[model samples]
Target: MNEAPNRNRPAREVIAGDRRYVWHPFTQHGTEGEPTVIARAKAATLFDADGTEILDLVSSWWTCTHGHAHPKLNAALAKQAAEFEHVMFAGFTHAPAVDLAERLVRLLPGDLSRVFFSDDGSTSVEVALKIAYQYWINRGEPRRTLLLAFDGGYHGDTLGAMSVGRGSQMFKPFRDLMCQVLVLPYPATFEGDDAVEEREAGALSAFQALLAERGQSIAAMIIEPLLQGAGGMRVCRPSFLKRLVETAQAFGVIVIFDEVMTGFGRTGTLFALEQADVVPDLVCLSKGLTAGYMPMAVTVAREAIFEAFLGESFDRALPHGHSFTANPLACAVACASLDLFEEEKTLERIQAINLRHRELLAELQRRSDVTRPRVLGSIVAFDVKDIGAYQSDESRKLKAWYLAHGLNIRPLGSTLYLMPPYCITDEEMSRAYAGLIEGLDSLKR
Candidate 1:
């Protein structure tokens, strides 16, 4: 009985094995179509089992900042693996993690000097949530358990993250189990948005009322900064963010900026907080932290907030950490990715992407099918009109059509968006926009 004669031999076998046992994240296997098996990938392009090249428009869920399999990051990962793969991070320190932490501190704003390692975006949010809760408790305010977040903001899928991301509709089944989190209106704005003042005032009034009533009870206020990614890529003004921070701070509520999606030059700055000149008490960062090369996240806090958790007694200190905390390989790749920001001028490339997106938005405005067009740095999005399905069937149809025509785009309900890798070429961008227009035309007929 030698394992049924070892029949598993080919690529198809591997794929079949995946289909048999693998349960994918954020996907419906019963109703939705089968997953496309990717074989190899490179900068801005992914190859399927049949070697069909698909231009990654959404950057594989808005990661892959420099692109897939970037040489520098790959080399760094290999070097680090050869030297030291991983080490338990409780008492030991590694050069890669330490250097990466130092680099992040310099890049971030204000006194966000302390970094706590984690595995992904959800854990990062969890870390921030825990830190904020304990920071108040450590300072002798154990009654402050209320957490505040914006409407239409999607944090992550963990219990704490989902509590803050109630507006995203991703956790309907577990709605009853999440902790208490208050949702405030988000003043989402776009091009030629003159009603922002009114919306901001209304939001401020609501926030003020909430703070006045529960200001002493609230532990922290977390936000997605200038852009809400999973909530239809809804962007707000920098002034709105600044004002929101000020309002939260005035209430003595700890401020946590969920920069998981907007970090690493996605919003025309290294960090979205820099664009608004706002200093949050804690910042949750992931996504492009390793330039999409590895899974890593950091919850960095201001010195004052970090100090709240310090004490001689074990019970007084924060006792949360992941097994893979500060994994050396992830840290090494992250360091290399940061280096590319300076060596390859990544932010400048983002500016070029932004310019192109602006030009595309101007042209897209002429098309009747496109509505509420918005462009933020490398991200461009618009809703397709008269598609009947909107966020449901229409979005699926448009996505399938795009895939058939050699593109990878995942639309949010009625919204079609493009957040291509920074290494995407001008010709590719033009082709992607052209394909989108063609999809809209087909939908019209």
Candidate 2:
């Protein structure tokens, strides 16, 4: 195979060529700034083509777990690539895929024993939705057509994902193409909020009321567990999740946990569901599944759910699969990534990061401009007051400021959040916090 002639081109020329052909995700090319050309990354820092070192505060969109260019992950990738990169996963199965599936089943909470592989977070959600829908159909209860999701919850950009996450307001143009999904008010909370319980009660009450009225029609309810990532980093109480799961399960509704963002120690645990102690009927996992090294996802379901689809005929089987389903290289990398979690004590690192976040966010909360400071595991987020929508001038200004200060921090509209890699040191975190304080102060000026 031959490589592109411009593979060795200068960064500026490469960027220029990219601008001419490539369209970036969630970016307005007409207004957004020039995309930075990243040369390499290691640990918690990204090196631009110009040799500028920028601290990765958002863990490269909250996917990176053990850090970039981890030796173990790299070795696993190289080893797998040298053996056989990929094979059609329809009838054929490989050791890497099988091993990964087994490991995931053992690691996940409750009786989540069956795994269906797909590509990326969106497809994982799509698979979960299909499984929930088909599981009901297999059980001769196809009337459960409605799917419930929380307000402001962002699953993904795919058609099915968009339908479930319709409240995110990112898919207005394609709204008509999506399936109808029921939305529930999320009991979003922050630091020092006294009305959290009241809000939780209200949400629970509303959810119970919905279940009472339309429980028989609802097929499943999907959630982002404790931390709603793209939904402005909204943090909810674990107790609320527990109650929500219990209520949904009682109504014979399948509970799907979209742990795409919260899995693999992001929420101070191996998975966010462990914090709530609630076992979801189906769990969608991606992002950190391969420690950000590969694009792979798995929707794990209960054994009983899997058993429902078992029949001799093709009609009975769940007819959903991707071309790269259970790619061997991705599976190999994911297994290695999971191994490092135990070898490197990744959960302990997350706990330390969580403690640092609380301390820094506490000080940030003192500023009148910063509101609704919240921290969970390695994540820290706060809202900026007086900033209009997600595409407001203030958000752009703050993003540029953070970039100028050697920090790769992206603000979600006015919601500034930090989710640095676990390899980040105390000093590095302090520098990020200091830059945040300076940036907030600059906004005042």
In the predicted model 1, the residue pairs found to clash are 391-413
Using TM-score, give the best candidate's number: 2
The residue-by-residue lDDT of candidate 2 on 1-445, one tens digit each, is 2222324677889789899999998889999888888877889988877768899999998899888999989999999999999999988999999999999999987789999999999999999999999888888998999999999999998999999999787788997899989999999999899999999999999999999899999999999999889989999999889999999999999999999999998988899999899889999999999999889999999999999999988787999999999999999999999899889998898889988988987688678888999999989999989566788898888889999889989889779999999999999998999998888888878
Q: Which portions of model 1 miss their true places by more than 4 Å?
A: 1-11, 387-391
Q: Give a tens-digit lDDT track for model 1, residues 1-445.
A: 1212123345577668878999988777776776777777889998876677899999998779999999999999999999989999988999999999999999887899999999999999999999999988899999999999889899999999999999777789999999999999999888877898999989989999999998999999989988999888898989988988998898889999999999998988999998789899999999899998788999999999888877788887778988899999999999999999999999999999999999888989998777788888889987677654334777788789999999998788777889999999999989988997887777766
Query: Each candidate: what lDDT?
Result: 0.88, 0.91
Stretches of model 2 off by over 4 angstroms after superposition: 1-7
- TM-score of every candidate relative to the true structure: 0.96, 0.97
